[model samples]
Target: MDDKSATFVVEGEGCEEDVLKWYYHGRSGRPNKNSGELSSKVKKYLSIKGWVFRYALKNGKKELQYQSPHGEVYNSLRMACKSYIDQGLGEGRMGNVDPKQPKKRKCLSIENQPLLKSVQSESPERRNKLKKQENRVVKTSKRVREGPVSSRNPRTVLSLLIDNNVVPMLGNVYYRNKTGPPLMKGRITRDGIQCHCCSKVFTLTAFEDHAGSTNHRPAANIILDDGTGRSLSDCQRQVSDSMKSTTTTLRTRSVVEIPKTVKAANSIRDENDGVCSACCGGGDLICCDYCPSSFHMKCIGLKEVPDGDWFCPYCCCGICGIGYVRDRSFRSCHQCELKFHGDCLNSKKPSEMKTEKNTLLLCSQNCERIFYGLQKLTGKPILVGNNLTWTLLTPDHRAHGGHGMKSSAKKENQCKLRAALEVMHECFEPSESVETGRDLIEDVIFGQVSKLKRLNFRGFYTVILEENGDLVSVATLRVYDNKVAEMPLVATRFKHRRRGMCRVLVDELEKNLVKLGVEKLVLPAVSTTLETWTNNFGFSCIPDDERSKLVQYSLLEFQGTITCQKLLK
Candidate 1:
C-alpha cells in the first residue's frame, strides 16, 4: 500500500476543535498497522475515557462494512452538521463542509477543507421572485369572516324549568293544570334572555331542581320548517328526481295521527271520524297495511268522512292511482284498491298537515319496493362463522330494569357479532359469503317500529323478541308492544354451532317477551329456518320481500272479537 495523505473535515466548530486536539495528541509514532499515527496522549485519553470509534468502512469498490465503537460516530456527525447549518454560519467564514471540489472537478469528499459564501445582497430578479412567492402563499390562505348567528327562538313553558327547578315528566303539564288557559309551551330566545316557562337555556351548573314541574309537560309542537328558499327547492328537486318513476302513483296508506283533543269535555267527537279501517275500532292512531307512512286526521284537512268510510287520499283504489268510493257512501283509496267509508280512515286534527306542497305521501313499504327492489332481489345469505364475545362496559348493576339492560346487552352484542363475522370472513372466503339470516331483518323490524311507538305516537302491538334467562330461542306469541322491551342479539361461539342454540335462544326470547307483556312474536327466517318459524313456533311468515316493508309478526289474539247484536232483550 502507498502512503496516502489523511484528511478530516469537522462538522461544527466545537466538533472541529475536539477532533483537531484528539488527532494531534493521539498520534506519536510513524503510522503502522499495529500502532497508527494517533498520538499516545490522545490514545491514552480515549482509552482512559473508554471511548471507541464507530464508522462504516468503504473499500475502493465503495461497499459498506459496519463497525461499532462506544458511540455512533456517523449519526453524531450528521446531527452536528445539521446544527451548524441551522445556525446560518455556513455563509460566514465558520466551519462548513464543501463536498464539491474544484480542479479534478471530481465528486469531492467531506474529508477536506470547508468553504464559505460572502454576504452579498441578492440580485433584483431573485428578490422580486421571492416577494412574489411570499404574496402567493399569503393569498392562498385568505378566509372570509363569518357573521354571528341570529337569535329568534320562541318562548314556551319549558323555559321555566331552566332557571327554576322543574323536572319535566310526561303528562306533567296536562294532568297538573288540566284546564288552564293553554299556557305557552315552548322555549324562548329573542334576546339573550329567556322566559322561565319556555326558554331552553338551562345552565349546566344549575343547582335548582329541574324535574317534576307542570312547566315540563306543556304541549309544545316541534315544527321543522324547511324554510322556503333555494335550499328547500334543491332538496325537493333531488327527492323528486330520485323517485322510481316520473309517473304519479297512489299507494296503500293509513292514518297515523290521533287528535290530542280527546280530554276536552263536551267535545262530541264524531264516532265515524275516529274508527280504524283495519280493525273497525276507534283507534286514536292507525298504521298502514303496506308502508310506514302515518297520517293525522287534521293533517289530511278532512272536514268530514261519512260512516263506513275508509282509505285516505293517498291510498290508490289500485285503479286510477287514487282512492275510490265504496258502496253506501264509503270513500275508497285510489291506490291499493281498498274500499271503505270516510270514518274508517281515522284522520288526524286539521292542524297537523305540514308536508310540503307538491310532495307525494308514500308509505315506507312502497318506497322500498319501488327503489330497493333490485337490492332485495339480489340480497344473499349472511356469511356466518365466528365465535363472538361482547363484554358490556356499562355496568349491568344499575338495573335499568330488564328491558333496558337486556336491550343494551343485545345492541352491544350485535356490534361485536358484526365484527366477529367480518373477521371470520377475512380468515375464510369473504367473496362467497352471504347474509341470508335473521340479523338483518331483525335490525329493520325493531328499528322502524320501536322508534314510532316511542314518540308517544299511535302504533300497534306487533312482534317482539325478549331474552329469557339468557337461554330462550324461539316461541309463539299473539300481540307485542313496540314500545316495551329491547331487541336481543344472537351470539355463536365455536363449540355452540349446529346444536340449535340460536333457535333455543330465540324461543326463550319470544316466551320471555310474552311474559313481559309482549303481544306478538316475530322473526325473519331464511330458507333454512322458514318452516321452523311457521310450523314449530306458530309464527306466520311475512312474505319475504314485504317483510322489509310491513311489520312482520303473527297476531295470536286468541280471545276472538264478537260484535254481538245488542238484541232487544
Candidate 2:
C-alpha cells in the first residue's frame, strides 16, 4: 500500500491497552480518547526511564515529519543503553559493534575465481558490435578528407590571410589602430629575419610568436591606410616620414675627429726651439690655435684675458677646450690672469677636459664659489664636486629653542668672521700652535695660492685672495654624533680671512650634517660669544636642566636663537 493509506490504517488502530485505566467514557468498539493520551504519557515516562521502543507511532503528527532513518535508529539505541544503565542490567558479551566502524565486504575465494571470470567475459555479438562502431568512425574521417579544398596553396593562403582580412598582423608589422604617425621603413634588413623599421633581427618563430611587435606594427599600419586598407598614398606618406626621422641629425651625435692625445703632442711642437711662432715676444711659450707656433700670451698684446680661451702663438691650441699639451705644460693660470708655460709654472699637464653643463674650469680654490653655490641651491648637506670640498655649519635647534644671547661685558665682541679660523684651528692641528699660515685666514680667499703642492691631500677647502693669484686654505673636520652632528674642530690659515670663507666652511659642514638626516647641530663655545648664535647665526638653546647629563658639560653656554634656513642645497 501507498504511504498515505498505511498512515490512515495505523491511525485508526488505538494504542494497545495498558493496565489500570480510569475512564470507560467511549463506546466499546471505539478507543478511549484518553487511551492514546495515556499511551503518549507512558511513552514519555519510558523515555525518562531510558527504555527503547520497538516501534514508533507511525500515524502521529510528529512521525509524519521526515527525519534521517539512521538518526532514528541511533536514537532508539541510545534510549536502550540509557534504560539498561538505569535498570542496572547487563547483557554480557553481546558483541555490540561500533556504529562508526563500517562492515567489511567479504573477498572472493580461489574456488569462486573461475565462476567470476565466466561472468565477466563478453559474448561474440558484443565484440562484433564494438568492431562496427570503430568502422563507422573510420568512414566518417575518410568522408571529411574527400571534401573540396580551397584554390590557394598553403603559402599563398597564409599570405592572403595576412594581406586580406583573413588573419591579423601582430606588433610593429602594423600601426596601432592606424593612429599616430608611421614608422620608418627600408631600414637595412640583413635578411628576412631583420626588421626594416626598427633595425632589429628576430627568428621566424619570434615574428609568429608575438604577433604584434611594438617595433613593426606602427610602420605597417602607416603603410596600410587607416580604415581604407593598404592605399598607395598612405604607403608613400609613411615612407616619407620614416626617411625624415632617420635622416635628421642629432645635436650630440658623434663626429669624426683626431684623438686629443695624438694631436696635442705632435701638432703644437714648434720647429724653433719649442718657441711660439704667433706671439713673438716670449719668455715661456704657449701654443696658438691656427698655427704650430708656441708664444706666451703675456709677451704679446693679450697679457691676461679673463675667462678667455685662446690658441697658442704656435697656432696649436684649439679655440675649443680640446687640445693636447706636454707634461708640466701650462695653458695659463686662470686665477693668475697670466699665461704660464709649463717650465715657468713648474706644473704638470692637467687632466683631459670633458664638456658638460655647469662645468667649472677653475683650480680647486677658484671653484669654491661654484661648490657653495651648488650647495645652497641644491640643499645637499655636503657639496663635493670637481675637486672642491664644502661643508655646512649648523646650530642645535633642539636644546636652544628660545634663549637670548649673552656675552661677557668685559670683552668687545669682534664680529669678524673668525669662526672659520676656529674650525681650521681645530680641524687640522691642535688648538695651540706656533703660528697659522696667512692663507689659513678664513673669510677672505678666492683660489688655491699654495699651487698644486698639496693636491694629494684631501681636506676641506678655503680660498684666499693673493697679490699673484689666489691662496689655498685647507683644514680637516672632526665628526661626532650628539643627537645631531657636531663639528668639534676646523682650521683655516690667517691670510684667508674676511673673504666669507668661514660662512662657506659652515655652509659645507652643515650640508654634511643635514645629508646624514641630522636636523640639529651642536657645538661648544664660550658664553661671551653668545651673539654669534643670536646675531650672526640662528640657533635656539635649551636650558642646562633639560639637557642629557652625558652631553650637558659638552653643550655650549651661548644663548640660542632659532633661525629658519635651508642648510643643504
Cα-based TM-score, every candidate: 0.20, 0.19
Model 2, TM vs. native? 0.19
Displacement of residue 534 (Cα, Å) in model 1 is 4.3
Best by TM-score: 1
Q: For residue 400, give model 1's deviation from the true position in Å.
A: 4.5
Tell me each candidate's RMSD, in Å, in order.
30.8, 45.3
RMSD of candidate 2 to the true fold? Answer: 45.3
The candidate that wins on lDDT is 2
lDDT of 1 by residue, 1-569 (tens): 12232322222112222323333233332344432332333233333333333333334322221112324333242233333333432234233323221001011111111112221364543322111101111010101111111111111122222222222222122112235442222222211122247544331111012323433211121111223222112322233333313222211111123233422311222211222222212222333323322333333343332233244433433223234443344442211123343454434111111222322222223322322221221112111222211121111221121113343233332322233332222122221101111122222222222221111111111121112111112211122222222221222322223566555445444443443343433432333334654565465543433322222111111011211100010
Q: Which ranges in model 2 have alpha carbons more than 4 Å from their true place?
A: 1-482, 549-569
Task: Name the lDDT value of residue 315 in candidate 1.
Answer: 44
lDDT of 2 by residue, 338-377 (tens): 2344343334333222223222223323223333332243
Deviation in Å, model 2, residue 560 alpha carbon: 17
